[model samples]
Target chain A: MDKGIDRRDFLKLIGIGGALIVMDTGRLAGAADNKMAQDTLSFIQLSDTHWGFNDPKINPDFAGTLRKAIAQINSMKSQPDFIIFSGDVTHTTDDPKERRRRMGEAREIIGGLRLKNVKMMPGEHDAGLDNGEAFQEYFGTTHYTFQQKDVNFIVVDNASDSTSSIGDTQLQWLSAEMEKLDKDSRIVVFTHRPLFELYPQWDWWTRDGAKAIDILMPYKNVVVFYGHIHQEHHHMTGHIAHHAARGMLFPLPAPGSVPKRVQIPWDNDQPYKGVGYRSAVPKKDAYGYDLTEFPIIKV
Target chain B: MTNIKYLLRIMVVISAVVLAFAWVHIARLAAETQTVQNPVANQGHEQVIKITVKRFDYTPNKIRLKKGVAVTLVFTSLDRTHGFNCPGLGVRTDIVPGKSNTLRIVPQKAGRYEFSCDVFCGDGHEDMSGEIIVED
Candidate 1:
């Protein structure tokens, strides 16, 4: 695998978006790195585009950045089976008209991609204020499950409630869903916020995520990918692997790294610093997923 | 011998009664203090209370004040950054590192208010919480 050999000059040689990274997640904590699944499907995970956010210092070219990423993925030789946008498709706004406008613009931009199978969930910014009203108009459902290549893909809606809770009723729904799956079934969970308390004070945690984790614990093979931290973070809750994606907009600092949880200063020298997306391809046995972090398309 | 034993028993009973009276008196004084907050402050004077916060706790974990009284809550961080968030009182302020952050709050009602450092301190950040008791 090209990822096996960490060529220092490889990234520079290929330029920004020509990244082909294949990380065998076996080395990641709680990731078994079991024999790769043969019949498993591959998909792209990107998050937090914040479509309507306007900050010149943070990202003056917000629309351009989103367009470029979509264009680059479309140009890929081999397309992913599907793509999942974890959350925050649009930035939060108090104005109802402006909120719908942003979602409409986001829908237009994302439609440029070559693939048709796209799954999206709302983030606190997109749905917290009106409880997924605008997002539902653009996208179909807040939370639902789909199966692809024998993998049960569960989308949990934790951002619909502004209070950062999955709620008890949704928890029961998740519990009932888990009862139908086999202990050895391959599961991939997509949500907006980290299911565990990565950092509660910064709103980086779900209020009742612990209960959701408790439900998923019975399964031997499970992984979670979420976006809200605005930077890539990998964590382990029991044997489950939870990975946070780098936001499509500007990136925020590490959890509690500074007095304020603000965006890292943008440098004209490194405009695309700390922004990227990931691709997860299953190995032969499909017991685990290997992630590839691709840099933002040069705009 | 019987008179001596009776006298000893009477002495024990007297000691128990005296201790019980003292306990009741102390309890009443504490209750009065809680209701009164700090009676030393004269009218129209703003109560100034300085508090410091560290890793996972506030030094003065509880603050007592009287209703309709304005208080200047002076806050400082002994180590890194922290916050004082009393949603019940509609007051929020950050505790700057090596600096003093202050907020003035006037309690309109008598009740218990909860506050915590909103900044992500560490694993035990949730523990860095306290209460504000406003008395009528």
Candidate 2:
């Protein structure tokens, strides 16, 4: 690997190459049929499942709802190349046994989908007890970089520290990793906490996320996705776009909009009105990402 | 004879100290086990209310009761973290997932008190709110 070519930049190069193939074809059907030839890679991002949570005040069938979401993903005509669970897999406590149990249950449910690969990050809830030691034990490395084709996927663990510090080691690793990739490569950063300040009072912002963003600023094609706020929010700063996914567990109020944060109560008469789903795709410029969100409703 | 009396007095003192220590220990245990008595014990009668915290909503969202009545609320979280907070009543407790959290509240004033989940459970978390109305 070249010193300036990071995994993300490399992945972006692959994405660009893939997009170029599609652009050359200039036909949707042809692009779809020749996806592999086009080098188009797709991945699913699911966030804030909050498994093992049973709250009648919210929904009695939270787990079932999550299963349905998984089913929806599995049933998609074009299966994602991989699945990324943004974070908050569990409600509270950092107990290893409980964490393991929840992870097992999630795996079992997702396993039925028979997906090829599932990658995960931890949310604050998942990292409540021991700085995500239990979560890391159940899942693999919290933060890592992977390259598929020409796109670089950087999975960082913001939940590992209370102040949301990427830590010196991870920062050094990221810097060195970025040094290996070309600046034009497309990069995707995934974490449980939003890299920018979403809402500080509710502990929504990562304290040291600016440090991570500072490092990523030099990259031309960078996109970040996170799940902790439990709602769909999108923003852009310079070349990077930030997106937050809707939580599968329940719906929360927007920051500072409510007098205080509370679990949105369930209305039996109006079931399935609160949940939402977010989808993203590479923008036309190939330097940004566009998002579309739909609220999940019972038919 | 005088020396014998002195020995007897020492044994008596030792026995008295042991008895006092045992008495204090037993008293402490009793106090630890005893439930804190309601200050308004004779102020009103007891009432039972069931509050369910589930995904999206709460059943019987509006809880109505008589003022000064002792309320025993049985709360349970249906899906995730739900908080039962009545700032007026100064009551706050987190209803954990899969477990029931019981609370005893004796409203001191004759007014409408509001309650909501403080934890950010999901998307509609802010809208997931309710109230407690106390009548005369």
Candidate 3:
């Protein structure tokens, strides 16, 4: 993957502030190399593991469910370039030590996957407990950006606050990051909560999401993949396509379809019903991606 | 003698009127404090607490249950999906619109237990929590 560009040059291009024109040149070059990067540019997303959650009626073996999900991803016909756990890595608790232990257990289980480049963001369950210290301890910065096949993947933490906001600091960083790219750059944003107002009554909307949306309005192709509602949903915010993924733990009722957010119960026969993940492939010479849903393998 | 008789008669009438007013006040107080047994508690379903969760709040957000009684929480969402997560009780349920979710819990200890919506349903998801108060 390392062409002639050294580490310094690569960093200088992707870096913000002083790194604008260089990034533009690199992006132009990236356009030519995108065809070769397309095949291996696909990635998998699994979310709402709720590792510490245990309930006989809903999901008794939460960890086991995640293992089966990993098995499914590992046994895929082709490996994805990376895997991203959108958020809610573990169920939040008042005990910080217990939360850390759950995070450790989740890491050990997720580590069993074949892919090495796994990135994670925090759902409210992981961040809202201790204000994201435990989550940051396991997974570095909650919000960050990386490039793969000319597509920029921006992962941010909006669950740190009960209001589901990206905070002023993260918002500033997001704007700065967006400034480094041209309007035509393919940007895929991964967040724990829906950036748009999916349903405010149920706390499905980000408090300060419009600010971030306003910043990205100038961009031609901005797709968002979020996990919180634990269902397969798609929305359009200007040019951006917001898609929410299914959870690994349990699925919830659709927005406005239910009065409260409750887990969908498993059938007597099919216990793993409605439990699944998704894989996405960024299209070449375009700003959108194709998504495919895969259900968890039955035990 | 006639004047004395008349004075006694007037005093008796006033006493009777005062007594009648006191009786009515007492009756009203009794009615106000009367514990109308929640029909849900007596359904022979062991334990049941029907909770209605809506966009911004949960109906009966403060539940007082008898300690050591097994309780089933019948949760329903009125607007959108809301989570009923009680970490202390190790109970979590989703209240979906148009349907009901049930959670069974037995409170062995008398204490305050808090629960909230774990799922992000909207901007107010954080404040969308309730508490269960158990009494001995």
Candidate 4:
């Protein structure tokens, strides 16, 4: 209870302290409020890395930029408990060997970080071949549920079909998972596609997102984070707050604003060049999430 | 008197005649069908605008024009797949590698319009964005 520490610093300290304590506790079960009193578990998100891309127009130092993101995350005075790579781990290609090579390289780079834990979800690019069997093989289960403190963290594989979709089986699994959670538990969901309709014409939305939303409606505190649009966007529906993160790669124009869905090329003369970052905090309001965003340019 | 030579000559003449006829037939088929028309070029007297989509950025990040003026956007993708989309103006076109895409849009109302690539081209794919400004 040091009064001198600022709020962010205090949170960071708590996060680091909590991670250490959790590591010692061995069992994360029933240690919620006790852990909260001593420390808080804060995690960092890195999305849409699209590794193995060698476009000189982006950054001949693309790998270097990724290393920068990792460095920034690691340099946080209070290290994050874990890191989640939201999606798009690699560029889309038909060659299986090429896909594996790209993913393997990305994994090696991320593994170089030596973090305690890392979680990932597949984007349309990663899941280009049906249910993302290759992605799952390289990574792990595409959809699964986990718990940290009193929060129920559900990572869903929405990039299951041609259009971003959480198949009926996944939906059923989601429904069953929610039934077991406590009424007061906070729910944080992650996916690679926007759960809400951003732009259907360009396939930016999940076809069965409304159904997934319906499943979470019973929860009082629900927050959903997705990465695909590659821009920072926040929307609220009932008790749920949906957020889309800026991509680590390039940015896309706002939906329906451009003549077509096309890549906005790079300009060398611009002051701000590459990468973006977003931070979110639980709002003071009973049901709200506040996000602060900024562009991370290469030097 | 020269039956073998005459027979060989006859075969060669027949082969040449067949090839000539086939060539004309193929040429006729090619001329009969019109190629895919450039959508923007079809709009006569429209204000022509050029848009270039390269690796990770758009050439004129912002486009400004007068309202109600017909716009003919001629776009080409320098690299992979790129999209030019303006939801407000109901314009969405995809530019593929080695192909040119064009669209004709007439904005009736004056406002700020945003455009972005829907394709995941590369690492910087998420940051690709541009804008169109329509004024009265």
Candidate 5:
């Protein structure tokens, strides 16, 4: 519960120097490429909507909550440039047809957004049942890379393997990408589960996360944002700052802090407690992201 | 008929603007990560810093240094005794009042190594910590 370490302040101290730039191999060189290199873009990360989930005791308004969260982002005066759903977009289903149906329904629900660029990866709930066959059909590519504001954004699919390993294939893809960046270049990684072993018993730890960390260990400014834990948490694996986003569905107990990994019964008093989403604004004064948590809209 | 043609022309213009706006976003997202032609050199000159440790916290809790630079952190405890343990970076040391203690490190890589007091000094021992940032 006590994050103890002070990463927010430490990251603020990381100087941006100048806008770090990387041109597309051949086409669109020069200042034309720098258009997106500006650090003013902001994005929101909404995780674990768990569409098709039906548990009134834990979340009576599960369906309503999911829509309202999207509406809340839609209503923002300054709409985010992008949205990254960390994982578990739908409730886990054993039936193959049902899984695709849930994915379709959930995609339609999230499609209500006014903006596009809604990037999503899979979670064990969506992928583990079939090694991501259902999810990839709807979302395409379990893992990939993109860039914004001179900062490289990588989405690593740890959920696809079911065992929660980055897998040798994806890890090699990650290493190849890592090799391309300058040591001082800024990088932000997104994963469904925590990259470091937070609580293996509770499935918080990635099977081969340490190896991924070793690959990313050399970078000067690399931050990993993930979801799986239903509650907000922050931890430090050396220099890399790992922050977990709360689920859009229901909240779970802290790692082994409780007897079981059960969801806390929905509270009428604090319906949105231990649950919400995160928005990150690239700090203009410095080099890293300034992250803030936002609650789901009640209406 | 001329009015109808004009309306069609206006619609085409609006669509083009919309299409162009979308392309910028697509292109940005499409941009690939490339290997650095010449990565920054890791090694730098040596440096030194003075730090103070106390109950529940560390003074100047954040320190920044260049990667591959050898540096010594001269530490002194204001109260009893505390420890600076950074397992990630493999750097640890004890801070004792009226005693000489220091951590000499040459960070081969750039990272945010969070060091905390390993020895339990008091109830506030957990909060007694600081960060060492090695940059390229």
Candidate 6:
């Protein structure tokens, strides 16, 4: 409860606490409100690592950036309960062999983290063309829901499909899943692309996301965390909070902010300027979680 | 067994009546012969088509052309890096933003061919594609 302990320090502090709590990722999303403790529960969300991507102008040190992120997470005084990689774990490659190689390298890099409980979703780059074949082969299911304490974490696969949609089957699955949760439950949804339309012109919006939004409208507290756009963005639809995290590889200009959707030029002096990760802790009683972004800065 | 046989006979009769009606209509239509014109003839011999590649879609999703005529595609992207690849036609070009890439062809045959974006622009990259229709 030290006010001086920022999120980064807080994560380092959490690791020292006793007992490795293994909560069900399922109950983590739908059924664990009663288990909510007075203390806040926190976790890290990292996205768009773009492993194996070789763009010197945008991010020449892409591999080093990831390694640095893992180092930061590992050096924490206390470790988060789990870490969630929102999507785009690997950059796109038409060669299936290269794609698998990138996935393996990404897995090996992320394996360095002290936290063992890791959850992942897909970025369109990972699953879009292959319909999640390569991603599923490496990361398992594209969509699922889990629970931790009083919070519900729903991870849907909107990236693997070219339409950038949570397919009809996953949409129906979401609706049916919401039926089982209380209207007052705190729900956190994670996907690779924004669940609500951020900017359709840049392919930022999911085609049928409104259907998923409609299903969650009844819920009192709902927040979405996604990562396709490659920058930090916050938008609200009704009571739902939608947040896009900063990608680990590079940043893209805001919607229509530029003439085209190009990577923000890397600051020569500042290498990993706008790229980083985020952490959130639950609020009292199931209202919502407080969020903080930690950018990777040079020492 | 008898009831099943009767039902089959009724179905066969109904099909026969439907076929007879279709035959009469065809016979009457055949008697009313009309001249059909080739629309491609009016479209000129050489054609220029511009395609703007956005995130996951091509502005001109379908391009119409006359067989054995020159067609030029002036391709540019409104967004990130995209590629145009038509394997059947052996045509591939990179569509970069702020620049135009042209692919020219004179299709020798009348048929439909597809072109796709092979570059990884974003999550919707796979969905970016268009078609070419050559009319005889």
Estimate, for each residue in A81-154, the C-alpha lDDT of model 5 and write its tens digit.
78999999988766889889999999998899876889999888888758889998998888999987677899
* lDDT of the structure predicted as candidate 3: 0.77
Which runs in model 6 stand beyond 4 Å of their true positions?
A1-38, B1-136
If you score just chain A, what TM-score does every candidate get? 0.87, 0.82, 0.85, 0.82, 0.86, 0.86
DockQ of 3: 0.07
Per residue, candidate 1 scores C-alpha lDDT tens digits across B14-101 of: 9999999999999999978954664333335668776778977886778898999888888878887667777678877778887769
- Ranked by lDDT from best down, the candidates are 1, 3, 6, 5, 4, 2
RMSD of each: 16.2, 14.6, 15.8, 11.4, 32.4, 18.9
DockQ of all candidate complexes: 0.03, 0.06, 0.07, 0.08, 0.01, 0.03
Tens-digit lDDT track for model 4 on B1-136? Answer: 5999999999999999999999999988765552322222333666777677886788767888789888888887886677676666878777887776888888898988777665545445545777789999
For each candidate, give its TM-score against the true structure.
0.65, 0.60, 0.65, 0.62, 0.60, 0.65
- Write down the worst ten-residue block by lDDT for model 5 chain A: A21-30
lDDT score, residue A107, model 1? 94
Model 6 docking tier (incorrect/acceptable/medium/high): incorrect
lDDT of 1 by residue, A159-256 (tens): 88766779999999999998999998989999899999786555677878999999999999999999988898899887899989999878888876
Which has the higher lDDT value, candidate number 1 or candidate number 3?
Answer: 1
Q: Which of the predicted structures, 1 or 3, would earn the higher DockQ when compared with the native? A: 3
Best candidate per lDDT, number?
1
lDDT by residue (tens digit), candidate 3, B1-136: 9999999999999999999999999998876664343425545758677888886688878898888888888888877666776756766666778886999888888887766675555434556767788899
Candidate 3's error at A164, in angstroms?
1.5
Quote the lDDT for B82 in model 5. Answer: 69
lDDT of 6 by residue, B1-136 (tens): 9999999999999999999999999987765542122212222555667677888888777778888888788887887667777655767777889886988888888887776675556545646767778899
Q: Residues B15-118, candidate 2, lDDT per residue (tens digit)?
A: 99999999999998876664232111222456666666786577667877777767788787777666666666777677887776888877777876656654
Among these predicted structures, which one has the highest DockQ?
Answer: 4
| Deviation (Å) of A282 in candidate 5 | 2.3
lDDT of 5 by residue, B1-136 (tens): 9999999999999999999999998876654321122211233554657677787677667888888878877788887666676655777676889999988888899987666665544333434566778899
Taken in order, the candidates have interface RMSDs of 9.8, 7.8, 9.5, 6.2, 16.3, 8.1
Better of 1 and 6 by lDDT: 1
